[model samples]
Target: MSVHETPRRPLRVSFEFFPPKTEAMEETLWSSVEKLAPLRPDFVSVTYGAGGSTRERTHRTVARLVSETDLPVAAHLTTVDATRAEVDDVLEEYWQAGVRHIVALRGDPPGGLGEAYAPHPGGYANAAELTAGAKARHDFEVTVGCYPEKHPESPHFEADIEMLKRKVDAGASRAITQFFYDNDVYERYLERVRAAGIDIPIVPGIMPVTNYKSLMRMAGLCGASIPRRVARLFENLDGDPATRQLVAATVAADQCLDLAERGVGEFHFYTLNRAEMAYALCHMLGVRPT
Candidate 1:
């Protein structure tokens, strides 16, 4: 008898976290990190707040991760409300702090989404320029964001693909997509990206839906659409945290398994500084601790 192997590549997962604002939240973040670290993620990224609002907090969290853990940490850099020199200094700081990977972004304006983005007088205009600048500064492995449903500011998906190609040309080693629920949407976007001749690992961003209202809000801002069927799954679980957690895990697991069966090997999860759900999802996906 012939033996058929799994026919799937080993799944590689990474996570994204935001720097905490208070002592309690900081503890929670570290606890989550400790809990998820055992699954052996490829890396964990720390996010910068809008317009560099969480600049110092992000730096401190990243630096602490460098000092305290054996896990690889990626510092997020943004060209929002900061000059070229300012951003350069932050990059240098990350280097000195033992962070060699960066997730470069053209951050949202301080006034928030829908507000016009104005590049600082002496700063990089967008993620592509920021990627180039980081490459020039150091041999950092830079990753940039792409949107599967098209960026809110982008005129269309074609333009978004063109901009993504520019980022790759500028020096991005990989592109991690914005959080998306629809695997078909991601597959279609991948086809376009490949057709456009952009060759780089495009990791799907996964956001587990623990809070329905918050997820809807974020989906609106990032241009990710939630399917009506999935919406109906969370219809009556609003007040039950226990039931919501189960639904969230089941939905995320189904999504990941579908992508895996489609030959997707890498996943970048937006953990939202919570570990239980993400850890549960990883466990469900067979990413158990070594």
Candidate 2:
């Protein structure tokens, strides 16, 4: 290390996990949780499935986090097919169970990805409306979603920025972006967001790519483009899990390091309910338990 080299900033990170559906998956989820718990991330989030299908399981997992660990847990809530009353009840349930933060979203419809989303007959119409609803019920610290590469459904970038501003106005405290391989995309998005006067913490969502095929599928669905250079790095590692994991950790750590150099200090990892890759990325970024 040279004296002229720049100092790395302290990084604050959070992990996202999903509710387990089966007994073995449940055990796996808890084991992953135990492994990452020691790092004491800023907060941990649990995802809600499309159309809120995993509502009960998400609630159960969050409640257990509250009771079993001294971690700050954020529960994902989505307005998909449920009415406002139903959504309100779920928020109250989380409140009673000691969850304070929420990632409110207008989730994918039950029809699945690429299908047009129509709000429930008596439900909040979009994420901005959902944010308002959550704030009305309780003074929750709400987080909303953002897309660096314009959302697939959005007509243009300007419209996406407008929607984010509306969500902020409706009481959302932060916005987490969809995962993207290009840090420049995020930097440009931040400029646009600030130019539009939406002042909120826009956390970059980092997804460590352990499986190339699965990553491409999600990137397709979310409109994140995989730069050909990155694609070249993972080419032909399909049958070699060890090499694949190494490439994944290195790619993700490089992404985080590049962003950190640009003055971004916070990151939210889409853990896919695994610990090794995310844990390794954090270590590479110099983040450790407090």
- Clash number for each model: 0, 0
- For 59-150, candidate 2 gives per-residue lDDT tens digits of 99999999999999999999898999999999999999999999998898797777888989999999999999999999899999999998
TM-scores for the candidates: 0.95, 0.95
Off by over 4 Å in 2: 1-9
Model 2 Cα displacement at 165 (Å)?
A: 0.3
Residue 278's lDDT within candidate 1 is 81
Report, for every candidate in turn, its global Cα lDDT versus the true structure.
0.89, 0.88
Q: List the candidate 1 regions with Cα displacement exceeding 4 Å.
A: 1-8
Clashes of 2: 0
Question: In candidate 2, where is summed lDDT lowest over 10 consecutive residues?
Answer: 1-10
TM for candidate 1 is 0.95
Q: Could you give candidate 1's per-residue lDDT for residues 18-114 as a string of tens digits?
A: 9999999999999999999999999999999887789899999999999999999999999999999999999999999999999999998888876
lDDT of 2: 0.88
